[model samples]
Target: MTGCKVVAIGGSAGSIPVVAELLQALPANFQFTVIIILHRLKNVSSSMDTILAGKRSGIMIAEPDDKEVIEGNRVYLAPQNYHLLIEADKTISLDYSEPVHYSRPSIDVTFESVAQAYADKAVAVLLSGANPDGADGLLAIVSQGGMAIVQDPATAEYPAMPQAAIDRNRDVVILTPETIASFLHTLND
Candidate 1:
């Protein structure tokens, strides 16, 4: 994981529990910046950052502002109704473009930007989702020589999302939530 500087996680339905589990498993000082894009309602207020910031994880979690610098060992959540993009200079930019696939904060939008920004130094994970939103983005990451990980459909609460990614990306690593957590914990070793 020497060259991998970012870990991009995208999910929809049934993703919160898995994300929490992964966060709990990851060491506080995990080297890569963790960017999360979870499909959320457009107008609803959110406390996702606080909810994910349990004592065990001890990681700083926040919703990123436009043009905010990306820092390692922190977790950034995509704000509702806005798409998140990573800049070449390791900063984040928020966009209010029309929704893709009927959703803003689209996983595909964030994943593709991260692939371009980090190239081979990025890892993208597609977790449980009801809709097939993250497939193309995960493929984009793989196409850019980045690693792709998909939740095992059998273990997913909703399999459509992970299954879509597996269908599109031949090199995706499929793992259960627990296994995925353990694998991620080794990134900085």
Candidate 2:
């Protein structure tokens, strides 16, 4: 999948550390676009974009803006208090809405949009999270012929997200933090 269109990674609560480890494993000029949808507080400001940017060498990290173009080598996070949906053209849609799984920037919404936007050219990965929000969406991606991966539920600090994906889908890669990074590096290769 050298020409894969996008890689969508999602997480929550325990996302900070998992995301850091994952980003460190990818090359700076990674071949595919990386979009992240981590649960965030609606009222509080998130430093995730800046923080991920600082930790990763070549991955440009920023919050998604409405109609913004998606590009490779950059990581886009859904902003707080909004659903970050995507267009068929790979542009972004940021909508302020009620929370799902009690999260404003819900992972399922992002995955669902990407499943539609990128179709078979997408990859969806779910990490540690406190809720099962991304499970259904991850399955949607798989149904659309996209690859789906989940962190090992047993190893995840919070396993709801990973476990949910497991229950909903089969043959999903379940990996540890370090191994997850290595796998991503290999996949992006």
Candidate 3:
């Protein structure tokens, strides 16, 4: 889809490596704002943003402070223990509400919010995870006329997440990690 403004990616369990691979493949000048929501442990400190930043192929990466304005050529990660939300004004909001699917920073919350915020100008990607957290969220994006991409179950470290999304929306584009990056690059062009 042309005029895409934001790409929301959600995952858990074995998704980190897949996320790294995808980020590494994106060109330095990629123009869409990227938001990532990964299930993480509560009360535990993680340097995930630093780790992902290390793999950056020119895109900036960081965990956004609440109310930060969304920007392109950057990747924003949802902090652990907070639900990440996209505001209609193109800013990020952090919520400490009850967890969804037994996890805070629920993929469903972020994806659904992005669907509402960006609508047809959004892209949602569902990746590897041990649970079914992201399936409904991917469907939400599709319902809003946004593009949905699900990692191929065969290539996932834990297939439940991607499989769940596929089960929910069979029409979503299914691709391996490498191909997902290639497809995203086309969107930039």
lDDT for every model? 0.90, 0.84, 0.90
lDDT, residue 13, model 3: 87
lDDT of 1 by residue, 68-128 (tens): 9999888999988999999889899999999988889999999999999999999988999
- Per-candidate TM-scores read 0.96, 0.94, 0.96
Q: Where does candidate 1 stray beyond 4 Å? A: 55-57
Flag regions of model 2 displaced more than 4 Å.
none
* Cα-lDDT of candidate 1: 0.90
Candidate scoring better on TM-score of 2 and 3: 3
* lDDT (Cα, 0-100) at 179 in candidate 2: 80
Residue 114, model 2, lDDT: 94
**What is the C-alpha local distance difference test score of candidate 3?**
0.90
